[model samples]
Target: MKTLNTRLDNAIKKLYTAFHNNTLHPECCKQCAVGNILDNSDSWKHFSDEHGSTKLNYVGRVNEAFGKRFNGYTPSELLQIEVTFLKACGYQLPIHYKNTKPDTPTDKDVLFNGLQAVIEFLCKLDNNLNVMDYTKIFDKIKCDFIEKSPVK
Candidate 1:
């Protein structure tokens, strides 16, 4: 049986390859929670210049953001797994904000908070050494994970 880590690794590679090959739509990525955070944050360029990929930087950022570690999982490995899991569960990028209101937080802020919540939940599960499928967990929490605003 393939280990969860192995599955995640393969998934990450596949997505990254698709993206680089132009098979994955750039807009799709921009909408994804992970992609949105990486693209908008300073970490994108910093990590890209250092690791050659923003995806790897995300893993490290999770560690810094949460102050926790997953056993037997490097930052890169964890990020690949998380991204793969998120994509498999059909999470799309957040709606872009117009930033019309300077005082109020933008859509990106809300989305980033939501993504952080999801990551924190995942990390807690990982820290507990739970090996269940990520999709199941996401299904249980997705409604709350991604907040929605009423359409005008």
Candidate 2:
């Protein structure tokens, strides 16, 4: 049987890649059913072929939008609830903040505990994890972390 920790790790991987690596475009081969369920039309942004800078629209979280509908929302006005939620949950934008900026875990802490906190926090939501699994990955990270600990 698969452990919860592994499951959580998988969940973190899913969300991380979804945010940082998933490609977006209008003409997709993947089947999308969320638009029908949410009853809102999708707006696909056009690409600038010169640089491939297609500012495609992300399909933001539906649950968050539905929650807002009761608090006064219209399909015409889109609330960036997913990004808002991640910001609230301490998920840093641009990712560099986690490594170099204030209001975040220092490199030492990340080497020891920060990544676990990230996984646990994200797992509390739609993620497929809880917290303990981070402990396991920590073992794998510790060797490199200690080896590369900045001596300053």
Weakest 10 consecutive residues of candidate 2 by summed lDDT: 44-53
Clashing pairs in 2: none
lDDT of 1: 0.39
In TM-score terms, candidate 2 sits at 0.24
Candidate 2 has an lDDT of 0.32
lDDT of each: 0.39, 0.32
TM-score list, all predictions? 0.23, 0.24
Off by over 4 Å in 2: 1-7, 11-106, 126-129, 133-152
How far off is residue 86 in model 2, in Å? 9.8
Per-candidate Cα RMSD to the true structure, in Å, reads 16.4, 13.9
Q: Identify the leading candidate in terms of TM-score.
A: 2
How much does candidate 1 score in TM-score? 0.23
Residue 124, model 1: Cα distance from true site in angstroms:
23
Tens-place lDDT digits, model 1, residues 1-152: 12355433333344344444434322244333334334322332222223223254554675646655333344554445334434333334221243122232223443334344444444454453323346767876877656664556
